[model samples]
Target: MEEKKRSGAARYCTVPSCKNNSVRNEGYSFFSFPKQTDRALIRFTRVNYYLLKWERRNMTLPKVFVDIVAKHPHKVAFYFEDDIWSFQRVDEYSNRVANFFLSEGYQRGDCVALLLESRPEYICLWLGLSKIGVKAALINTNLTGDSLVHSIEVAGSKAVVFGSDFKNALKDIQPKIVNLKKYQFNENIWLSPPLFDDAKDLRTCLKEAAMDAVTEHIAKGNLKDHILYIYTSGTTGLPKAAVITNVRYMVMAVGLNKMVAVQNNDCIYDSLPLYHTAGGIVGTGQALLCGGTVAIRKKFSATNFWKDCVKYRCTIAQYIGETCRYLLAADDKNLVKHNVRAMFGNGLKAQIWKPFAEKFGIKEIFEFYGATESNSNLVNIDSTVGAVGFVPFYARFLYPVSLVQCDEVTGEPLRDVNGRYITCGENEPGVLIGKISTLRAVNQFTGYADKVATEKKILRDVFNEGDMYFNTGDILMYDDFGYFYFKDRTGDTFRWKGENVSTSEIEAVISDIAHLSDAVVYGVEVPGAEGKAGMAAIVDQTRSLDLEQFAEGLRKHLPVYAQPIFIRLMDSVELTGTFKLIKRDLVVEGFNIDIVKDDIFFYDVKTKRFVPLTRELYELIMKGEISCPDNFD
Candidate 1:
């Protein structure tokens, strides 16, 4: 830290005629990483070897704006559609932006909301905020109106910088804000430009930002306080903001980079929507930290995706289960032409995992599990073939994770009088409640002014009196190998014939049939079926699914009763602010064929034309006597 202070005050003298004249300070800025020989860095990077030596100690995250410039200044730091930013230029831009934020009264611990997409601007803002020790509250640009407002308010932002495209959403809450800065750029948001016209054009906006900054000196804060909030896709109630504190789990950057050992020359094609953690935290962050460049995009586009990967020479990439599946559905004469060696991200299903890897010719597939708030993450480096893998922390809790049970009839969690909820044995499905302890380091939620809403998520007196745990609302079923399997989200599980059906597990199969871009599975009400009837809303890939073909496939694959009673062909599935499918809205509408205008599909055991779901068929389907699988067979 003393060395850090002196860094800003260093000076040099110019000699004239063999006489040293005056000294001028060439002060190093926050954006500067101290230069070192290759020898020194090789020695320093050995810190990776003895990291446990520094456990429980404070170490700043190596801001890529600093370290990256020091090592690979001229290498591309970011690339998008047709634009590219060099590490040197990115370092300079982030420095000016940091200085700008500082001049604007932004300081350490101050929350600055970034409403943008996965552009270079997002990276610049992230680096700039970290350099100045300000906390970045990254907002999802997809959110609109109230959902957007609720997120910003929950973050307790000291300032906000809105993108040009989302200016309308910003305008909705400008009056509610105390201090804000409206920044407009070209149409694509979050800094990664589709193309860089010239350095001067890029510099113009940054220079304006620098001039308007409002602080005397930038504050230095602990790494734990740097990032403030990350929003979860609210499929259940409203979307809630999750904090990303440093004190708890160290950012996974170091471990993940080590797992991949990505080369500094690697160009990581990352188009996973900057609002997602994979894009922002894991994608860009991992690449930048390794001195590799990030090839970014606003969102994933199946058509131009691989072309861009080859165009940018992407060596690494990331994906969700569905995105990879989408790619699998594409025409792939050129899929093998790209430089994609390894891919990382979650949600890749077991059934398709092997096929996707083999088809893509991918060398490594890294499957990981984590949430924005949890202290645990399971990283699968061994390509463990088809498991979520294991983290020590997660492995430690698997037994406890399965044992807890909630009421079947009512969703209200049942707790003992002592407040300690019982956990399931190994491999049993149960809700995962994070154990609260003095050592429990986690990013607490950003409450929406309603304490009751906040209180609903907490469980008290677990394991001991006064101990509290946050309800993750996710159910996990563990395998015997310390690998936990993802179960359905709360309310996604339906009971039929006294058996629980995981909507996700079922949809994973339904979605694999080269069918739709999306499949949202939910339980619909049935008159006598004990719990709920399994219904699926599918968005057909061709906009027209052959009912006979789909029914034939479903009947061949699924159990007699497991086949969906009704299949609604929807043009679009409504997603929440966080891009998660909203089943509640789908549930409210139910299976009323007349009430919903979307194309309804029904399988008739006698004459299965995959009939247009009518009121009479829908009524019969809900009566528990309909054997949907018997139609095609």
Candidate 2:
């Protein structure tokens, strides 16, 4: 295959008065092209070869940021609301943060809890911690009380640095985390409480610290050391802190930057929370790696989303499935006014993929698939609609991912008569697992801070004895073209009538209904029922559900067992900071009309209509008196 031509012009040389252009090759630069014609080609080839070798050997998060600072100190590194920080400014700020921590008796390998919103300070602090060999445990700002305490405690954090925005949340968990030292950002030291007596303004500290602190720390840093602890969303239970090493951060930054073809002049608009991997490592880190500017938003507002993009002159934007859905629901006519050429992130459902692209005028939807802790990554670089990623058969050995048959009820990999896990056939949905190897450290699973939680994510003795793999806990399938499609979460798939029911599949179909804003599908338990029954929480914008039209659409598209039996008309569905639906509460409430205040509807098979589920009908269904056509013993 012929190599693709490089995009755009060469970057200006960083060296003063060099009068040479940095040559771009394979998404990275290799110094400036020499003017000597006699040895130009030979010199170019030699330089490129050595740079590639050096990149593979010495690439690390701190090293990359330092290199960018050296190359383009005046370049804008980040834009947060009304503030803009240049590469040199951020580097100096991070140096001060490292110096302050060192003065506080904090040493390498110490874990410091960071509970801050999506701001320039958050990134600076994280980078500073990495420079000094300290790990920053990124806690979700929305978390409170037990959940907050669990995340910090699990990471074994010695200190907690929090912003003023989280004062209430910090107060609520103060008693629980009394043992840990507290420090408040942007606060007057004298006004802070005794517990937070060490509070000092970041800017003040940066101004006072020596300039060489960052340089000395970076030189002593090792790539193998842990730099971050990102907590999971905890959709099932309490969250777990996934360890992120410098090696992992470097891989994520470089891989995403190269895949997206990020350039120095490009500006990336990011609205997702920094605590999430998509916002931090993949979105912001990609820009930092490529010497591009990152536009950070405090929170996602569909009304102001396009305006912000236009204001920031963003060439690329990051999104999740719900972010696109919310934007599509808004009445913003400025959607087509931005310069965004590509939309990058995961969870872009097949139903919304084309409409979102066309409506927003996006040229490419760079959908990718990977969990925070998982080593396996897949990116759809070919612009294939609805495909999370593609891995050719020839590249399967390098990727090392497998779709294995799973037991529907337990959500465990199914074994054959010989006790070996069965690999799924082509086009069949199964749990995706990645082979773990210590030889290739990038492919190894670093797991969570909690040993029990870490062990739960590993599946052993699969295919061969003494072999291990990391369970992704996600169901996926691939087609003849090797394109992978997301099905549902392992826990979200329920067994009914001897068939597996995917909640995501049902939700996708339900989303096609007119005037429906959102839908969250899940399985609910019914007394005397053989398996869980399908239920959905739907947000209808019209305030009137056309049951006849909805029933007809369901009958035409979905199988009998796949259709939701109970429909709870909710005002809105709760979502996490990253835009993932919170289904645990809805699943617990079920279809009980007495407990749930929302209007409930039951599909009446005999009348072929959805009727109000009153107290009388709910009791009858609970008693197993009402017989539904889809329900089978």
Candidate 3:
């Protein structure tokens, strides 16, 4: 039979009998957040409808990949650096890994930790492990010492597969986890003898192992079985292992593929870390499940993002957190023209969403909202400016998501006299919750590996006596049109000056006024203050922030209580794998000049200006002598 080919830009319904087209392709107006028309309702109703037909019947991701490989063995699956990985090659490589592990007496229900940079081998190792019902714990590469050991130990990993570049990190915890079978592989070239005495060379073992496919019985798993454990960002505290079942993975991947209208020939430019759900699952799903090519980058470079897209002829791209902001800050001369049509992910603020799309010539920006463990998921089908996602009135019954009033200080869901959780009215900020149901895989929440942590997220007797809902830990407000907008994280909103202040709102305003890519906003406890005081941290290496202009902007844009009292000028702000600001350390340091090496400035309320936080001034503020704006209750 002659080989079949499809254009990268080709568009049509994937289901044979279905005639409905994507909202983007059907000429829907891009001006609004909500669509009430029958056409709009029909278009969104088909989301994941095609995938649902076979999703329950499909076994695992590896099985799906094998099927795709059989159909298109020679198709390019991954473009990593200068190398191109074909589907057949990836399958064979994974088979070798599976065979090696099986030969070493590894069996079903075993956990293996993966500590490697973003690369094709990283995916192959995890996929291969999944072939034998072994779960892969995707560890963040940036972690070291105690954090690294905790992540591995929490997952109960019997073995660890690490890149040669991270041998030192493994070595640091090698004594602590002496029982762990350490397997190492070098990205460049394999060492003759392993550099670490305790570590084994994984490449040599794979080369020695057979490349034949494992038998179906040995490689089978229930769709609900856990295949991967993806850790949370640890922005709030220690990272929690969020369980990623095969069914959950399938739902996430298929949902993105269907909603984005991904084509088989489309190339996705993925610059996110492979450990993250956005990069590992959603981004890779475009090519792995939907069929296409994924261009991988070891690290995200704002300067090279566009250049790489152009280099790989990528038709689609991914972004999360401050990625778009960083790109906007990059020198325009280096941002070469590209053929990217659609960009998807979360955290593109409304302030820069339109400008970033317009400047880069992107046609559609599909912003989505979902967490690693939560079942509540939403996607913006229309390019409504600033809308994270929309749950139209017509689709609310299908989605089963609602916003409930929450205590401003404690972040606990507020209940009425009847002991029932109060649902927020339109335009009211509240904690978003998703009703948990086992009928469909999309509405299920697997939660964390720790049962205690898992239970903390479940709200029993939420609306009824026995019903349960997953607390998203996010504050969201939906407009009258049912267009949901992100407000802040539950714990991130601080009480100040007898009012609740949202850190996200302050950060967005500060980032805009500073003309910077990102800013970190948090509340710090003052010695004499009634509540936590607002603090903003901006990355300004030179300490040349225009204090007068910034103060003026703050006065105009923010109220007295919302305005940050302390500003920390840092050389750079630490970010997580997903580009989320790490505020724990900053919050710990607070505004203490002795502890913080960076320059600190205090907002002079009397003068309506900002001045350096000198020792005398700090003492005066600590002693409650410094005059300030209205005090908190």
Candidate 4:
């Protein structure tokens, strides 16, 4: 829903849902080590939310086309839970699907909405669309109401393949779907126990269309053809659809295969949602390019993860930091059973890097740094502690990036007239900005209807000329050896539970509770953290706060992903001259809960209420002696 826009300093909370998003300076704003003055006015406006710079992708995804048929046509390429398909078989089936669509008059660049979740058929649909240059609009499963409706309209999808199970959810707007040709998903297979029977049955319905005619159209497909649309989690209020060209897919595939050492026989185990880039780009595209094997799980199951790894004999598994923490907490005996030798993905924290590696016997760890809209990327195959990895050139071709001094009130970065910002010397931390060369800018997107979305991501006039560079929106500290260490993400997004936690989503539920006028939520370091812990800084309505009621209320309404673990109750809220909650101070204070001389309250998950953070409880959490659900089962 729409909310009021606060004036001047008060406007901090006006960017959609801010009360639940921002960090309060009342006594617990997140701490910052800002450099000296002489910068532009930097009052806390919501972190520049939209600026994303996706580096240029390879113009074409590495293709097998006629070559793979000559190479390893007989080897199995796809194995469903119940059925297996060889490369030659998949080649024919996808061709059939591609042919079916073309016979139905489908053309290149047409938008086809995919409502199916993670399954073998979903991948087939994606690959088949790629063969014909059609775009797949991967809709977020969590979207609802107007947001869900708006996503389809904005994408202008020509047709929707809605999962049979989710079709009823869209019944309200089904009749109103304009420019829509058909709504087909699990027409029969998405029913009953799917024993690879759905895909098998789908072959029959497609038989009416002449497969011979489909051939002429498939020949026109190229690496630069398919447009893959990855929708952002609306945790940022409104999600934007990123345009992924076939070239982008190819680049990631090649880069990941080389960096992660994925060979034709290696298995890639992915439990992450295919809707995400980590799943689609790195998992699916990369595997397809290498002609390797990929085993897909229905979804991420903590208890079932390692078992799946061993079950599939997976060599390379993709992971999120939060997931690692959970895996680390699992019974130590289970770690040795898996054949997983290497792990890849981002958000693996520095604190737990070595311990996790040693515990799980993971030999190679490739931590990469890239957003859907990235200008550069670092793939650390060496498993460097917290380092995103190394960029080839352009970025490293120039100088080091690190944190610097800036105006506390207004966060204007200090750059010189030459358009080059001051480097954070050797072994210093600075804002990591990838130099956007003509080549690296290829993967950049022309967003869905938001002009500001495009402009906000560009930082113009660098190098004394009026050239534009997309900002990474992250802080990186450099060391004496030219290695980059991730400092933090410089926006409202904080990591928790292996996912990006939108500060605004957290604040929305928090501010709704009575007596809580404002809430600032962020991820903080929990001892032995695989990722950040959710912490909220809130304003109490009464001297005798009803924290028990507050905890109960949040527990009832919010999902596990959005809840705050530590609650720091402030006497009053503090804002800047511009009314922005200063986080630097509060981040430094953290949630000492009981140690600090404040009326702070900690939520006891087991006790089911708020209790003062006594020193004993704090030590218990730090020592890893406390039995809690902070980690996965």
**Candidate 3: which pairs clash?**
none
Question: Which of 1 and 2 is ahead in lDDT?
Answer: 2
List ranges where model 1 is wrong by over 4 Å: 1-57, 62-65, 171-180, 187-205, 208-219, 234-236, 247-249, 259-266, 391-403, 408-419, 436-458, 465-468, 491-633
Q: Which prediction has the highest lDDT against the true structure?
A: 3
Where in model 2 is the C-alpha error above 4 Å? 1-58, 187-207, 233-236, 334-336, 492-633
lDDT, candidate 3, at 293: 89
Q: Write the per-residue lDDT of candidate 2 for residues 481-505, one digit (tens) a residue.
A: 4668887666656644323466766
Q: How many pairs of residues in model 2 come into backbone collision?
A: 0
Better of 2 and 3 by lDDT: 3
- RMSD of every candidate to native, in Å, equals 17.7, 14.1, 13.2, 12.8
Compute each candidate's TM-score over C-alphas: 0.64, 0.71, 0.75, 0.75
Ranking by lDDT: 3, 2, 4, 1
User: Candidate 4 on 52-160: residue-level lDDT in tens?
Assistant: 1112212233244335644888876655455666667666666666777776677887888777677766776766776777788887655544445666766778777
Give each model's whole-structure lDDT.
0.59, 0.73, 0.77, 0.60
Per-residue lDDT of 35-123 in model 1, one digit per residue for the tens?
Answer: 21122234324424423332344444433235556776788888876877887777677777787767667767677777766778777
